[model samples]
Target: MKGFSMYIGGISIKNKIFISNILIIVVFISTQSYFANTISQKAIIEKEINNSSRELVLIQNNLQTLVSTIEDYSKILASDYRLQNELYNDLLLNTKHEDSKPVGGLNNLSMKKTLSETISNIVEPNTKIKAVSILTSNHHWVDVGFADNAYASRIFGDGYGPEDRYYLPVWTSLIKFGFLYEGEDSVFAVSKTVIHKDTGKMIGRIFLYVKETTIASIYEEGENKGGDFYIVDSAGRIISSQNKAKLYRDFKEAVSISLPETGKDTTFTQGSGSEEMLIFTHRFEPLKWTIVSAIPMKNISSGRKEINQLILGVGAACLLLALIVSFLLSRSITRHIFQLAKTMRQIRSGQMQVRSPYQSKDEIGYLSEGFNNLMDRMEALMAENVEKQRTKAEIEFKLLQSQVKPHFLYNTVETIISLIKLGLGKQAIQAAQYMANFYKISLSKGDDIIPIGEEMRLTESYLEIQQLRYVEYMEYTMEIDHDIMSYSIPKLTLQPIVENAIYHGLKLKKEKGIIRISGRRNGNQLEIEIYDNGAGMHKNQIKAIMDGTSVPDEINGFGIRSVSNRIRMLYGERYGLQVESEYGVYTKIIVVLPLRYH
Candidate 1:
């Protein structure tokens, strides 16, 4: 019985191990299949979304093309009308000889009577006859046959008045299509030339009369497609439309539609309730009118529903597959999870030395490297933050110190002005004025840059005061180009260099020293030079200043350093002030800046 019990226990243990191995194999195969399917479905969905976006863009382009074509057509029509009218008037003016022909008794009377009757019929029946005249080159009325003659009678009648004589030069210069009078009812006219059969010269003028109805007809014809089409005047008033009740209406509502300021075709929708519509306005360049076509939004988007439904059906199927695959794949994708978990756990426990293992060269590997990089960046950022805080505090202290020096100088100048006023009158006034100018520039509302002209003026004021103290010890000349005077430059950039040249370079010199200040344009750069033939520095000092390694003993190298820093900040390190000096001969400071024009 003991041997049999041992055998059964051994078999049961073997069976349990076999079942566990098979279950592991099955789970692995299923997870792999799910991940493959999920990736495939996602690709299809992304492709479809991209295609839909492209289609929408194409539709917008098509609409813009249609709007542009219509606007071009309107412009051509307006140009053609103007050109034809000018040609007709030129023909009539050149044919003054035909007016001298004598008329037979009955033939002339019958023809004149018929012409008068035709004109009266065309004019508005309610309006009375003002006058009628046939113009000659001599500026006299040849005949006034009757109240009803031809199309010309309506225009020449009482509404025109006797002062409305068509002067030859003025008539020839009139535009083709425009309102000639400002009354309740406007008149539009088109000119035509009537030539003699034998001579082939223009003997008469035929003016085509256009009443309010003519414009109304045009608007009605254009608005037949169920969208509102109106003829707007240059001032944005609706002159004619299918809806006569809305005639002469102010188009402020439509004109208020926001459009891109760039002169291009644009569309916008506005208004509400029954008035809501999508308006497409294109500028008619020749007529100076904005031809607007408004269509209901519903009309444009109605057909889109069917296409959207088709997209929806395809999208729904894709989404269902994605969800099923995503669920199974989430369990299978353990590579990224394992790496992330290891790194995170190390980070949580305050281990900055943690790094992700470079396992597979795929997205997972990239993610691991990215995490390590992020950690390195965080450490660097903390160190940089501390350094930045220290630097900012230093800069604030320097700025405060610089501010106090200017105020103190201003106060001292003011005291000197009072003393000079009591003793020396002329010197007092000059000193006070120079002092005012110097303080104005020094304070400058804390502006970093001032115009080149202003800076030159400021430097002159400073030099004026310095010359009084030095008394012909130094002579300075400034030569600046007129074109570069308006360019912006850092304030006090030239003055400090001039001061350094005067005090450090020229102070101990026995003979008179010459300081030259000049500016010139070099390609896209402006070069300013301050050179003095005074006591110059050694090579070692020049190197120290350029490298920013050593500070000057007398003055805190703060002024030169400030100018250099400002140039670097405004332009870049590539542009700044350079110092070059030769021992006991000359010292030159050159400032380089980008050429800017206002």
Candidate 2:
């Protein structure tokens, strides 16, 4: 220990500090990892198993409610007095008229029309319902929905016994085992037998049908949980499953496992090695359905493993972090000297802007300040100062765009949702795509500069989405020269100006407002003007904005100040924004740039 202490003391203080911190961090982290792994491993596994079971139960309840709701709807339809009367008459008519085309007579047509209207009403409210059918005891059918009646006809035909009227067989009857849903869709059916209470006579059967997606949606979360879900009957037949190829197969065939005769809802492990599965089962006893989840046991243990690995990873990270922190600590003790040395090294490598940011009243601070002043004068002489200014403008413009983005995005999302609700789905999708493009180009993967063409496209997309919400009152036109389209410009230059025109100008107009953007190049400079025919500002308002004496409220200038400052700062004081307007007549904003927009 004495020899080691002498060795540490002999080295430089920076190395000594670095070594000491590393040893301390290693010791502390090793102890923490030991306790964390030993104490929390089993607890994490147990808690995770319980959480998985709870999630399974929650998903099972959703399925239970869905099936029960469909059955209840079937019940309501079966008990419909008019529907029953129509079916009973149809039954008698089929038995009398040979059941060949029941729509031949006026009375039959009227009965069929009534049944169609009733079934349409039922299907309208529930988008998931693919079809609803009514079949008399004699196999006469009235079907309403998009699906072909051929499958329902074959499933609900006369070959079945009395048990077929229940929900389990009704679902199973339509499924073909080992047939993947990709080959043909699975149409799940729920049957309820119709009968007259007073007459004590069987009239017909009402069947409610939906695509497998409707049932799969109930357990969609389970599907994403690195597992598969199945609805099994008491007979152990797999009636509904996410991997539809296994539908209607025995549970044993899908995953063979031994079970206790407890007839209980349980979670247990099955199989060996990679074939192992963590099985979760919950019974829907009312309909004799068991919702089963077969997840890989590996998934169950992954949490425990990740926690153990995470602790070890944290230990490794801390060891690395300690070295960096110790080095920084030694340098901080003589920060002025260290920073001045670093700045000198960076300037040697041609980084002129690398000035020591440290300032103080000490002698070392004066030395750094003198060094920084020398570099500043040298930077200006070298003509590299413009690059520094351009970088500053880039950062400020990026911030400006980020600040205004959320407000515009929030408004756009509402418009998209409204379009969807109004059943203008195509328009909604188009608007959403336009919104994506607007942000995509405006952001451009952290690039503050973009082509003028890209900026125009971004502006157009923004306008399209805004027009979606105000089609009656707003429109825009762009007349930009193709030659200057490839010119480099700062991002978000024109959009904010147009946005200001719409919000502060056009929105206040009593009539429809038009926004026109025209661009032209003058020598080495490019000029773009945004004109809006609406409530224009007065001379005083424009002065307050240009003089920077306007109200500090965000909505007042409508973001024009930020755009103006950014332009002048990037190009020069000669370039920026100029406003012209007459109150209640029109507003126009002319933007000057050296072919760059910010």
Candidate 3:
């Protein structure tokens, strides 16, 4: 089983599904075929039986109409005063001529002729009647036959039963021709008693024989097809049948089957030997008779065999269809999967631009699009990393340059010497001490970031040294927020801007210029503002400086631009320097940085 599973797994999905569905289709066809024969056999038998019952119902209706008409004939004969007087006169004549009875020979021919003519007038009009006869209370009788040699005496004799009771009509069970005649057979009839309408007294009994062939005609189709048909009374006595031997036989004795209590249509099997037959029975409630059909088991089995073969043929066609559909659906799904897998393999092998070409709005299509988007983001990040590296190196070189610039050292040394030559030892010592403090904080042990307090101290020392050098020409003020003194900022960030203010703005002014430096914390940001009341430059000059287009001419020392770039590089573009100035009024440089405590 394990090996078989591996074999199936190795095959393409289309073939696997085709194979699996073949098995399923086989099972389905097998199950359907079994049930089709098992269930449909019973269903077909029931439907055929019900169909036979409907045909029998039509025959029953015809029989009822014939019987009802016969009853009407009896009423007509009883109500006719002329006919009643003739019957009474015949009774009197027969009593007087008792020796002239027509028993062994034809006696009283004239009387018989007159009475036969009278009965013929009524029974001859009805085509369904084979013979009609009357028996008076005094035992005088006469009969007329519609068919040749139809012996009314043989068909119905003096034997009187409940069916022949006075003033009531009833149908009799089948009986044979009383006196064997050529071409004569058994027959049944509807009989009633005739009465004098005015006196309401029973006169005599009268009977009408209906040809047995009429009952046989009801099931002519079944008989032609070699099947037996029967009409039985409610007592289960066969009243009429195609088979003369079956007529008058008890139903249970002939077929060994019991009728249902509801008298509905039913089918059953009877007999075990060659007599075995499929019997279908339907009861006609109006006639209180059950119509039955019997077909041999051999005949019924032959038809069932044909039906089974047809069902098998249809099942085979459905199985083939399922196979084709399964193969087509599996192929569509696996084709998309294969394309995605191939594209993923290419991507794994460093072909980042490769993509699956599935454009359908399905799950596979979504996965393909997601894969392509992921590649795009990866490529963008790679380029951004390279750019960041280049910018970092440029900022480092500028910081190195600022730390070792020679003119800054030379100017500070000359300022201290001039002060020393004036014999102002204390001021000279203070100037030297301030320069020492500024360099110590600016270097910050080679670290680029320092506390806000130390950065401010560095700027203050440089301003004090510059003030001593320009005494009357330079004035400075510092307004530092003590709360933000511990916040971290880029080292030497403020000192460069201050130096630019003095060299570019304050130094060029004629009157003593004021340079104010203030640091404070604003929301999530730390801001240091440098304002100079000097000869401020125009917007064009500030733009050129910010854009790195202006060349530094020894005194500017790349200080402002370097500080702006370093602030942006370290804390992102949102934290940087903004310059605001007016020509000859005031120049304000605000350095913004993210607030971070050391």
> Cα RMSD to native, each candidate?
40.5, 44.2, 17.1
Model 1, span 185-300: residue lDDT tens: 33343333333344444334434334444444433433222566554556666654556665556666544444344444456667775656666655544444444555554444
Candidate 2 local Cα displacement, residue 271, angstroms: 4.5
- Candidate 1: which stretches are off by over 4 Å? 1-423
TM-score (C-alpha, index-matched) for candidate 1: 0.36
Q: How big is the positional error of residue 569 in model 1, measured in Å on the Cα after superposition?
A: 2.3
Report the CA-based lDDT of candidate 3 relative to the real structure: 0.73
Clashes of each: 8, 3, 0
| Shift in Å, residue 262, candidate 3 | 5.8
Of candidates 2 and 1, the better by TM-score: 2
> How does each model score on TM-score?
0.36, 0.43, 0.44
- Which of 1 and 3 is the better model by lDDT? 3
Ranking of all predicted structures according to lDDT, beginning with the best and ending with the worst: 2, 3, 1
Candidate order, TM-score descending: 3, 2, 1
Model 2 regions more than 4 Å off: 1-35, 92-108, 124-127, 143-149, 164-184, 222-224, 256-261, 271-276, 304-306, 313-598
Best by lDDT: 2
lDDT by residue (175-266, candidate 2, tens digit) is 52111223356666777778865575677777676666677778875533487778777787777777777877777867685544466888
Model 2 lDDT at residue 457: 96
